[model samples]
Target chain A: MELTLGPLAYHWPADIRRDFYARIADEAPVGTVYLGEVICSKRAPFHEPDLPATIERLERGGKRVVLSSLAEVMLKREREATAGLMAAEDHEVEVNNAAGLMDRGRRPHRIGPFLNAYNEATIAWMAGQGATHVCLPAELPGHSAAVAARAARALGVGVEVQVFGRAPLAVSARCYHARAHGRHKDNCQFVCEDDPDGMPLLTLDGKPLLRVNGIQTQSESYVELVEALPELAAAGVSHARLLPQAVDMVAVARVFADHLGGMCDATEARARLAGICAGVSFSNGFFHGVAGYRHIARLGTAH
Target chain B: MTGAEDFSAAGELVCPAGTPAALRTAVEAGADTVYCGLRNATNARNFPGLNFTPEELQASVAFAHARGAKVLLAVNTYPPAGQLALWHEAAAIGMRAGVDAFIVADMGVARHIAETWPRARLHLSVQAAASSPEAIRYYCTHFGVRRVVLPRILTIPEIRAIRREIPCEIETFVFGNHGLMVEGRCSLTNWLTGQSTNLDGVCSPAAEVTFERADDGTMRSCLSGFTIDRFAAGETAGYPTICKGRYAAPHRPEGYYAFEEPVSLNLGRLLPELMAAGVHAFKIEGRQRSKSYVRQVVGAFRRAVDSIRSGHDPDLADLVALTEGQKETQGAFQTKKWR
Candidate 1:
């Protein structure tokens, strides 16, 4: 299968974002790159002006680029931006909400995880709406993922799964990062940039629970699915999208690419990935139909 | 949109009914519209020992209709892949029962209802999580939704802004368990337990819920072996959802309500403001509650809506005692707070 770099879900300095994508375009083996802000819309202006240049750079590298719409479109400006994204004809658009779907009309678009397409009928309905690819929700078990992937294959739609990064667990209208910093959503200075990955949330027993990123809450542990790559491909998944993180993504991509090419052992690639993302935990419970924090290495073999 | 003349009285008193008795109690207590779900995963409140059979729903609909009240069927959960037929069957059963409208959340379900049962009236369930006018307008234009339930995240002015832009009717929660998480968008419970609130319509399924007492004389509520919230001795315990639980974060040694404390939402005081803001219905959100709760809360809202129309002050003092922990807040309606 192909490895696609998912949209950047966190806020970073514009220069860092620009440099990161530049390095990916130059060195990373990722076939496709999703560029745009899928989180808070307020973070758009910081990086939007530089997007055309970044897209140009990536396209110049022979990488396919897809523009992503916001996950939750509540404001008028966010809606207009979504409509504008749909109107753009140069690149493919990934719709994350119904507003985007409404604006897309007859255009062949990609459906993001935010818009739930759980069952076969949902996928068929989305295909009828001219959706060409769909990223299943992050909480699907291996069994469900296989079922959905097979269904997508039957409908001639490519299925994508989140193979890396902290899986998003929730999205809220209120900004938890701003709330934690004692500021309202409207007037608060963007405080989510403090944690380039995401701010960690712990349980009362001092156990890590989730990461807070503005209005989105994600699993505390990054979901590493390198071992499940074979199962995903066997299930008819066409793409495994890796969300960007504050790490050497070029090395991360190379490791994933090496695994796909059968040039590196799983142990060595995993060890290399571990060295890149130090002090971070990994979990694959959602893939096993168990608690999200639990790392179940084996799939249906478990229970 | 239906004209104000269709609802010549005060704001509609929309009530919740988990059981048949609760449905009858709510109707007898003067609820203008009573909403309930079938005994399946189609509805958001898919609790055990709750909801109705098809026959029970038909009888309840006739009872409510005889009393000049409308019964709405809530089929508001996302269907998992290959399980779409279940939701379609749910809508068909609701239509057979002669319910006035269907409250739906999933886009596929909405499309199915709009296409297969074009004559059926549709209301957007809060589980759809459409808080903006653009989102609501999309549903109205695509699915012919007659009303949209506002998610519990919008302020009064935001609701008013949406009311001005959309042609659909508005409904907002006036009482019950406050979901701090955005409706329809949360999967924390699904991450912990196999069931999903958005798809299976069950959150922290009872099968995965456990309460244990610590030696320190505190009650700890756990969902799927993970602690959701702990209560001190003699402290009342709320339902263990991952969002409203206490937790510890870095730099903060003491465990606190990292998301939100367990406080119920009480918008009773803002009945007049809500009516003036163009909310067509005031919804009471407790399908898992008791028949007495259904009777008392619906009765209070009925009187409050009447009082507001007659130019009298609403009596909402008694609602405080009925709330979880007997504490309430005008959540998100007054203004957005950091907590």
Candidate 2:
């Protein structure tokens, strides 16, 4: 099993963003890399100029680079931007929502986690559409991913899993943050940047429920599949995607890579991960049909 | 010499059938069309204890057609990646069972229908989020789209503008639960877990939802194991969906409707105005409702539309108890009070 560093979903500046990828390029131990702006279309221009150097550095470090696309697809401007990204003759592209690519007739691309790939037909269809690797949606339970992995193997498409970071749950045209602040989407003036990770929303009783980005809302807890490494490998998951977070990403990558290589067990990895993470919690509920938040192991709850 | 069959409008009273009995009730209540789906992602209303199987759908179609009603099978959810076959087979089966139309979303699924049934009368599902006339017109121009159920985000005037632009007929939601979703794409359900109302055609799967008693004498309704809101005794609590419930946001410290309240949309009073705006059909919004709800909502809407056509005022107060939140709004039709 190998580790794949997925695209950063937040709106970090050019210096920080460049320096972050620079660290991954020089020192971080990961096999595959997905580099591009996967968030707002406006944010792409800031990172596009520096992408070539980042790609060159990562490629020199023996990593395969895949270009990422937007998550929420609607505006024609966003569509045109994605079209240009997909039309890049340089690197393989990962289709996020499968919007324009649906009728592109014949095009080679990687299907990202946001794209819906649930069963054999979708798997076969993606392979037929030229998907070399398909990252299953983060919401897909572990078993579903396993089943889809088997199907991918038959279709000659590889499967990837999201092992770390806050999983992006949904994207919308309406910016909840802007709407909350009584500002229109066009002139909202970069409010989402306050929470580099995302703004956590609590319930009426003060329990953390969800995190709100620009137009995206995610689980307040970062979903850590550190314990599911053996299970994921057994499920035929070849690549583990480590989503970027505002933490010790290098250390996080080291832990995930070590776990994937079978150097450490699930118990050791969980204990190490606990020390590095911030105030937020972690969950793996999508795997079971139980609550999205129900932890397999809790500190206070007696077994 | 004008007859009902020869009416230029051919205005169909599209109704919802949550149960097998409601299927019969809708047909008997002069509903021209009845729409439903299986209890899975095959339909948007993936509520528990509702929907039908292949045999049930076939039987429902026969029952409707035998009584001069048409069955429009709704296979509307965006088929999750690699799961297009479930939706594809649903379309094939709907056609084989003599369904009048196939309501659909997901460009991939739409492409499948276009390739398979070149002549099938396809109706774009509101879940497709085809809010603009240009978007609707694109579907009509590309696929063999015949009609579209406009999302609840548009005003009546906007609907009128869209009706003028698109070549296909337009269906507007008249009554029942109003989904505040931004149409074809909503991932709030999946954010909590991987299961969603969009992919597998469920919103908050019944199995994931649990009502718990809080220590402060309140009840919490959770979807995918997250608490959205809690209510005191006698305070009505609706089914929990992440996007809908009360929550504390960054700016708003006092907990309130973070996204939208689970209010039902009742547009019965605006039937005359909408028909005048060139809408061809009025859709009732409850497929998970009971047979009695089907009878009550469809019957009241039927009376209201007929009353408008006869140049008389229609009384829709009888539909108060059937709405999801026990309250109703005009949605985005009358004003900017939309979710």
Which candidate wins on TM-score? 1
Cα-based TM-score, every candidate: 0.94, 0.81
The CAPRI classification for model 1 reads as medium
Tell me the spans in candidate 2 whose CA falls farther than 4 Å from its real position. Answer: A42-62, A297-303, B1-13, B28-30, B39-41, B53-56, B76-96, B104-175, B182-200, B205-226, B232-234, B266-282, B299-339
Query: Which tens-of-lDDT digit does each residue in B8-123 have in candidate 1?
Result: 24499889999989999999999999999999989999999999999999999999989988888999988876677889999999988889899988878888988887778899
DockQ for the candidate 1 complex? 0.57
lDDT of 2 by residue, B1-339 (tens): 001122125346899887777889998887878988876678888777888888888888889878878788888886644456678788888877777778887656776877777767788998776765555665776676788888776777777766776788899888877666565456567655556666667676677788888677688888756787778876777788777788987677788776667777877667778888998988887787777778877887777777777877776565554554466778668864332
Per-prediction backbone clash count: 5, 14
Stretch of 10 with least lDDT, candidate 2 chain B? B1-10
Superposition error at B12 for model 1 (Å):
1.2
Clashing pairs in 1: A118-B81, A119-B80, A119-B81, A120-B81, A120-B82
After TM-score superposition, what is the CA distance of residue B287 in candidate 1 from its true location, in Å? Answer: 0.2
Sequence-dependent TM-score of model 2:
0.81
